[model samples]
Target: MHIQLVRHATLRVGYNGHILLVDPMLSQAGEMPATVNTPNQRPNPGVELPMSVEEVLDGVNAILITHTHMDHLDEAAVRQLPKHVPLFCQPPDREKLKNHGFEQVIVVEDDYEWEGIHFDRTGGRHGTGEIGEKMGPVSGFVLKARDGNEPTLYLTGDTIWCEEVEHALKSHQPDVVVPFAGAAQFLVGDPITMTKEDIVQLAQAAGNSQIFVAHMEVWNHCLLSRSELVEYVRANDLSDRIQIPQNGEKIEYQR
Candidate 1:
């Protein structure tokens, strides 16, 4: 299996003749507003799209939306994607996505099949305390193909490290794990996503799973930078298992 980190949380994952686009925020750089009030409050996507929308859209068989946040499911992505393409999302977001002109909105409550691959919605905690309640609901996915060659992949949605994340590690034991780790915060309250400390814990818990960290250096609210995270992983002796991919970079995995 291969997953391309197309800036922030957006990705193109291909396996077993199927290419699934996840959390597509296809807006051009500087088109969207800053996420929150902060020093890094320049624009939503600080960097431009590495490839054109046409390049990213090639070979896409379906769309898997983790949430309806502007950064995840923005206007550009909605208008660009084919209306008839299948959309897999959480139950809470089915209506909202349908209203956006998506023809097939499949809620990932149970296992949703695409061709031969199986997609199971995994639970996630977007934040903790009162902030979490206001952040709304979000869910991740555990995807595995029927063929033994494809390894199990867990894409943890916009979330902070919690029991649910650990449970997924212990239960599915995925070969490739993508966890959001920008420590994104607003003016007040704790970070809504995983911090360096949390990443350390997750690395320790994974045992041998490969981690490709996302949600960094994109939005104003995200406090972490690639350089900072790289140093943290190196200093903590977790660099061997973790990969901080560059924007538009791709990582291939085998079981």
Candidate 2:
């Protein structure tokens, strides 16, 4: 399968005559407010999109929405997306998308199959107890295509280390796991997502599974640096299994 890291948590998964747009966040730089309540915010991404929102979305078949956050499922992307394209999301987010004018909305339960892919929905906690309670519920997805050569992929939406995520690793055995590892934080609370150390621990638990780390250096709340992460992984001898992609870079995987 071909996976393109669009930016932040957004990705494009291509295989079996399909291009699935996962969490399309196509807004211009600085269009939204800073996620961290701090002074001296960093500049938003100045890079131009590879293609126009309309052009990139042309002939897109479906959208996989992990959550309703603006960065993951923004108002601009939702408004620009074709109404006919089917959207797969958790039950609660389905109504939100449908109300926004998306014609086809599929509210996935624990598992579902569409076209030639099998999708498994797993629970995710945004953070530890008190932090998670404030941030609200989240989820992750494991997708397996019919083609035996294609690698099974796990997309860990915004989440922290938890039993459910570990259980998914044991059960699905994905060839590649994409985790949001920006180590994002707010003004008054602990990190609401996986930190770099968390990524290291997750990689250890995942054993040989390849990991693609995203969600860093793109927003204000996320503070971890890719260079530092690379150093940590290399020092820990995890360079072989971990990949840190730059924005708009594409990586292909086969089983």
Q: Which is the leading candidate under TM-score?
A: 1
TM-score of each: 0.97, 0.93
What lDDT tens digits, residue by residue, belong to model 1 across residues 106-204? Answer: 998867877778888887788888888899998889898887679899999988889988998888888889998899887777888889888888889
Candidate 2 is scored at a TM of 0.93
lDDT of 2 at 102: 90
What is residue 133's positional error in candidate 1, in angstroms?
0.8
Q: In model 2, which runs have C-alpha deviations exceeding 4 angstroms? A: 36-51
For candidate 1, what is the lDDT?
Answer: 0.88
Candidate 1 residue pairs in backbone clash: none
Clashing pairs in 2: none
The whole-model lDDT of each prediction reads 0.88, 0.82
In Å, residue 16's CA in model 1 sits off its true spot by: 1.6
Best prediction by lDDT: 1
